[model samples]
Target: MAPLLICDNRAEVERERFVPGTPEFRRASLALFIASFLTFANIYITQPLLPLLVDEFDITPAVSSLTVSLTIFALGFALLIFGPVSDAVGRRPVMFWTMALAVLPALLAPLVSSINQLLLIRIAQGLLLAGLPSVAMAYLGEEFSPRALGLAVGLYISGNSIGGMSGRVISGMVAEAYSWRASFLVMGIIGLVGVILFYLLLPPSAHFKPAPAGLRKGLQDIGEHLRNGSLLKAYSIAFVIMFSFVGIFNYITFRLSGPPYNLSPAAVGWLFLTYSAGTISSTVSGRFIDLAGNRVAVILGVLIALGGVLITLLPALWAIVLGLLFFCFGFFAVHAAASAWANRQARRARASAMGLYLLFYYVGGSFGSTGLGFLWHARGWPGVTAGIIFMLALGLLLGLTLRDKD
Candidate 1:
C-alpha cells in the first residue's frame, strides 16, 4: 500500500528537534517516560489483584478478569477520540489533565462497595488514562529528531515495562499485607506525584501544527490509516502479541495461586520481577531497530516469545519464571519495534495513527484477559497455551508481511 502523505512544510521537516544531551531534550524524554510509566502502572494495578477481587466479591475467574478487561476496553475506544483531539488542540494538556483525572478513579477504587462499582471506577480511570499513551508516541514522533526518535520511543516503552512490573508487584504485596483497597490508594498516590512531575518536565510542543478538527475529519483520518495495508499489518501484530502476553499473565495468577503451587498473592506478584528482561530489551531495541530494521526485530521477538510460551509447559516453577522472562523480553521488542514503525509510516495525523494502533493493542488485551480467562476456567493452562500459540503463529505470519521502509 502507498504511504499516507501528511508531511509538514519542507522547511519545517528540516527544522531542529529535541536532540540528545540538550536540556530540553532531557526534559521532554523524562516527561514522556513518566507519562508512560504512570499510565501503565495505573492501568495494570488491578492485574495481580484479580484473584483477591474474585474471592472478596464472590465472582468467578472470568468475571474477576473484567476489572482489568473493562479498563482496557474503555481505554481502547477513548484513544479514538483523544488522538484527534490532541491533534486538533495540543498533546501536552491532553496528557496532563487526563493523568490528573485518572488518579481520582484510583482513589475512588478503595471505596467501591460492589464489583459493579469497582468496574465502573476502573472504566472511568481507563478513559482518563488514554490521554497519555494515545498521544505520547505521536508527540515524540512529531517533536523528536529522526535520529533520536527510536531511542526516545524505546526509553518511553521501557517505562511501560517498569511501570507494569512495579504496579503488579506493589499491588500484590500491599493487598496481601493490608487489603486490596489499600493497593489502590498507594497507586493513586504514586500517580498523583507522576502527574506533577510530567507537567513540570515536559516542554510544550514546538513543532506541532494543528490538524483539521471535527468528528468527520477524525473519522476520515482513521479511514485513510485503515486503508493502508502496511499499517494494518502493524495493528494486527499488536493485537496478537498483546493477546498472547495478557493471556499468559492473566491465567498464570490462577495457576500459581492454586493446587500444586499455592503461592500467596505477594509471591505471585514478585514473579513479575521477570519484567526486568522487557525493560532491558525495550531500551536496546531502539538501537537494534536502527541497525536491523523493524521486520527482523518483530520476527526475532515472535520466536523468542513462542519459545517462552513452550517453556512454561514444564511443571517446575523455575520453568514458569524462565518462560515469563523470555515472554516479556520478546513482548517488548515486538511492541517497541511495531510502535516506532507505525509512527514512522504515518505521514500526517500521527496521533490518530497511534490511536488506531492502541485501539487494537488494548482490544487484544481485553479479549485475551476475558477470553483466556474463560478458556482457563474450562480447560486450564494447556488450553491457554494452545490459544497463545495460535495467536503467536498468526502474529508471526503478519510480522513476515511488514516491509522495511525505503
Candidate 2:
C-alpha cells in the first residue's frame, strides 16, 4: 500500500466546500453552535451543584469534586475512542445520536437516591457525551474552508461559553430555589431541546471520508499524529488551559459559599455570567488570530489569563467578578485559537488529532479539579489561587513556543 492516503479526498471536495456566508454554511454553523452549547452544558451542569452535594453527602471537598472530575475523566478516555470511531463510520451519525443517548443519564440524575448512584449515572453520561467534541472538531475541518475555520471554531466555542454559563446559572438558581434534583431535571429538558434542534438543523457532512474500520488502524493513525512537535505542543496548551480553568471553577463555589461574603447559591451562579466575556473574546480572537498570527494571539491570551488570576487576589466582590470576566475571556480566547490550530495542523488525521487533544484536555481537568482541592482544603482561597496562576504561567510558556503562525 502506498502510505495510505490521509487528509482524505477533501481538497477535491473543497471546490464546493462550505465557506462562511452561504445558506448551507449558515445552517451548519448554527447546528454546530447548538451542538457545542448542549454538549458543554450537559458536561458541566453538576459544577454549581457541588456545594449542595457536599452538604447532602457530607463528603470532603475533594470527594465532592469527584462528581465533576469522574465524569470528565470518563469523557477524557471516551474522546480517544469516539473520535477514531467516527473517523471509520461517519460524523453525522456519531455526533447527533450519542448526544441523544446521553440525555437518558441526565434525566436519571435527579431520580438517583444516593451519591454513589448519581456518580455512576454521571459517569455513564460522560462516556456518551465524548462523541460530540472530537467529532465536531473533525466535522469543522472537513466541512469548512481554512479561511472560515477560525471564526467557525470561535462561534462553536462561544456557544460553549454560553452553555457553560447557562448551566451554572440555571442549575444554581434552581437548586437554590427548589432542589438539586429540580436543577438536573431542568438541564435534561434543555439538553433534549438542543438535541432535537441539532439533528434537524445540521446539514450533512459534504466532505467527510470514511476511514478504515477497527481499533487497530485508529490507534495507528493517532500515533502518527502524536509524533508531530507542533501538535504535541498544542496538546500541552489544551491540557494546561483546561486544568487551570476547570479547577478554578470547581472550587470557586466553595470559597464564595462559605466566605465572609457568604453569597447565596443563586448569587454564586450569577458569577458565571462573567463567562459572557468569553462569547465576545472567542469570536474576536478567532478573527484576529486568522489575520494576525498564532504566536502573538496565544501569548496575548495567556497574558490576559494571568492578569485575571492576579486580580482575584484583591479582596472586593466587584474585583473578584471582574477577575473572573478576564479569566473567562482569556481561556476562551486561547481555546478558540488552539482548537483551530490543532485542527489545521492535522491536515491528515484531523479526527484522531482532535480526539487526542480532548483526551488531554479533560484528563487534565479531572486531575486538576480533584488535585487542587487539596490546596483549597489545606491553605484556602489564596492557596488555590496561587496553584492556578502557576499552571497559567506554564501555559503561557508553552504558548510562546507554538510555530503555527497562521
Candidate 3:
C-alpha cells in the first residue's frame, strides 16, 4: 500500500509538468528567457561604460571596473541566500518580486553624484537580481519534463547571451550619443516591461515540493554538494570560463578605445555582436550534447575558446574581432555543457546546486573584472592573455576529469 501510494504521487507530479508541445511550456520558456535577459542585461550594461566612467569619475581603470565587479560580487553572495529561500518559500514569488524590485536600482543609477553612490546602487541591484538565476534552473528542473529540459536550458542561456550583448551594445551607443546615465535609464525601462511580461506568462510552479526550511538544512545541502567531487569539477570549470571571458572583455575596451583603433564606446559595443555566435552555439549545444556526450563537447569548447584567445594576439583589428567571435562561440558551448552537468549531477536541493555554481561563476567574473585590471596596467594585452591562458589550461585539465556518465 505504501509503495503504491508513493508511485501514485510520483506519477501525478510527472503528469503536472509542462510538456514540450503544450502552451504552458511555450509560455514558461519565453518567460524564463525574458527573465534571464533582464537579469544579464542589467548586470552587464555597465561593462562597456567602464572607460566612460573612468573619464566621468576621474578614476583609474581598476576603480572604474568596481561598478561591474562589486555588483557581481554582491550577486554572488545574494545567490547563497536566495537559492535556499526559494527552496523554502516558492520559486515564482521570489523570482517575480525581486525582479520587479531590481528595477529601482537601475533607475537610481542615473541619479548618482559620485562613483561610490553608483557602486552602491549597483550592489543593491545585484542583491535583488539573484532571485532569477539562483532559482530558474531549479524551476525548470521541477516544472519541465525531462525530455524538454535540455532545450529549455539551451534557450534560456541563448537569452543570456543575447541580453548581455544587447545591453553592452545599447549602453555603448547610448553613452556615446548622450551619456552613461541614459544607458541605465534605458535598462530600467526594459526591465519594467520584462517584469510585467514575466508575471503574466510564467505559469506558477505546480511541481515544486518545498524543502524543509532552515539554515541548518541549507548548510547540510551545501555541504553535500561540496562533498561531491563531480560538482566541484563543474564549479571549477565555471569559474575558469567566467574568469577568462570577463578578464578579456574588461580590458579589451581599453585596448580598442586607445591606440590605433581609437574606437568609440559605440564601436567597441558593436564588436560584441560576436556574441551572436553564442546564441547559435548555446541553442545547438543541447543537440550536440545528446550526440557527443558532455566530456567531448566541453573539451571541444575549451579548445575552441583557447584557440580564439590565441587568435586575438595577432596585431590587427580583424584578428581581434575574429577572435572574439570564436571566443563567444566557445564560451557558450562550455556554458551549455557545464550548466547541464551541474543540474544533472545534483540529486537533491537542485536550486542550491545551481546557486553554488553561480556563486563560483560570478565570483570568477568579479575577480577577472578587477584582478586583470592591474595586469592591463602593467603588461597590457599580452599579460592578460597569459593570465587567461593559465586559467583555461586549468579548465581544460578539469574538463578532462569529467566522465561521460555526467
Task: Give candidate 3 misplaced runs (Cα > 4 Å).
Answer: 1-15
Residue 171 in model 1: shift from native, Å?
A: 0.4
For each candidate in turn, give its C-alpha RMSD to the true structure in angstroms: 3.9, 3.7, 1.9
lDDT of 2 by residue, 30-92 (tens): 998888888888788888888889889888778888989999999988988888788888899
Q: Against the hidden reference, what TM-scores do the models get? A: 0.96, 0.95, 0.96
Which residue pairs come into collision in candidate 3? Answer: none
lDDT of 3 by residue, 129-168 (tens): 9999999999988889876677888889999999999999
User: 126-185, model 1: which lDDT tens digit per residue?
Assistant: 999999989999889878898888888899999999999998999999999999999999
Better of 2 and 3 by TM-score: 3
Instruction: Please report how far candidate 1 places residue 303 from its true position, in Å.
Output: 0.5
> Which window of 10 residues has the lowest lDDT sum in candidate 2?
1-10
Off by over 4 Å in 2: 1-15
- Model 2 pairs whose backbones collide: none
